[model samples]
Target: MIYNEISKVIDNKEIAENIFEAHLSSDNLSKIAKPGQFINILPSSSFDKTMRRPMSLSYQDSNSFKIIYKPIGDGTRIMRSWKEGDSADIIGPLGNAWEVSKNKEAILLGGGVGIAPILNLYNNIESTHPSHLFFGARKKEEHFIDHNPDKNIYISTDDGSAGIKGNLFEAMKSIFDINDFKDKSIYVCGPPMMMEAVRKFSVEHDIECHLALETIMACGIGICQGCTVEKCSDESSTDTYRNKYELVCMDGPIYKANEVKTCLL
Candidate 1:
């Protein structure tokens, strides 16, 4: 892991009680980064946390990238209290980014905190591919208002505080059924249940889909072998997924929609 320092910290806001954003600059990393990739973040050595937390590269310009995160534990809590001059270690633009191929249209699905990577993926594909974004959140407050773009963005909240009356999957089905979209590609990132639902919908409609998996990762690289998923096969012919234990950090945080199994979740 190539260690880097946090150059700039700007715009601190509490979207929710624990949910916050830390925008940092690492120009070298951002120059080579693509969509669907993430950066592992580590607070100071004096801090209590030893493990690095992975956060998606939220936005980038010519010089740097940013991360949207939540202060969930002691580590993030310490990081959130840091000032502009403080230092943090980062290791990315790592793993495979979302592939925006020649497909004319694609559907982007996001749930809860899962929206981070999906938002970046959407920005990369939106202009070229006609796309629809369907997001599910706990309530209207958790909808991640920062990432929702103006074009074709749809939302659903469990408490009926947002766009639709029910879950994200149901809202997705309703949008597709009403609009008569066909033969499009799909990209999904969310809870495992939501990913499973997306897989089912894609199968039913014969839509090609990709998924950004949100499984736990210990090493953000191929070493730990902690995060794995079963590959798609009727007969278990291939040994690609959790069967062999692929690392989420190195191999993928984003995988082919049909490539990984969701049965465990």
Candidate 2:
């Protein structure tokens, strides 16, 4: 279920160089929010922008939720200037969420802003099962987000500024035995190129991989038909099956890696 509410910004500040973290207080919205779900926020500024921006749920407690974003454009720049008392109408908790089965180990792979959802996923699986995180960014400057280093979290920077001098998958290969991945459930959410690399690795290794895809959305309710992705029958299935377009908003922002054609688009 989705809740539309005018929620107050409890706190707002820059957590990193260009990234701003905003905490919102809402009674009804926070209760139903789950890991991997996102919220559509109505911009109070940016009059020219007609549609709400979809921001992933970065952190959530019992009474409030939070989102971490970069003010890269007109809408987000305006959002950055918003004060704590300001209110915005947000619709959430939207999209399908991530899940883990009993006794199954989890491997989280995130790149760039795709790291947003993993925080929630980690919190859920932390005490229940063993979980590991692999994060990647373009540079060390972009690695401003916080995570427990003690909790088996590894990082890779493109410039070798921080941990491994490669991508998240490369970081993974350097740390753990690739053969052990077959028994683990991998969750990935990142850019297209990065996700493609992860998808290829997962397929080749015959691992259980789930991916969170990001795309431009308008309605965010599947009515806009804006975020369509090609659906594949299985990892080994060929083009002989007729291509089908699935709406990311409704069908998923989260999907099994083998169930979709990640390399095509």
lDDT of 1 by residue, 1-265 (tens): 3436555565455665466666676757777788788877776667655567777876766577766566777767876786775667777777788876574577777777677777777777777778888877878777666334466888888788878767777877777772364556778777777778878767666667787876766676676666666655556556545455456677787776666656243
Across residues 135-228, which tens digit of lDDT does each residue of candidate 2 receive? 7888877886444568788788888988788888787777779878767888888778888888888878888888888877888997878888
TM-score of each: 0.86, 0.91
Residue pairs with colliding backbones in model 2 are none
Q: Which stretches of candidate 2 lie over 4 Å from their true place?
A: 145-150, 234-243, 263-265
Which prediction has the highest lDDT against the true structure?
2
- Which lDDT values do the candidates have, in the order given? 0.70, 0.81
Candidate 1, position 198, lDDT: 76
Per-prediction CA RMSD (Å)? 3.0, 2.8
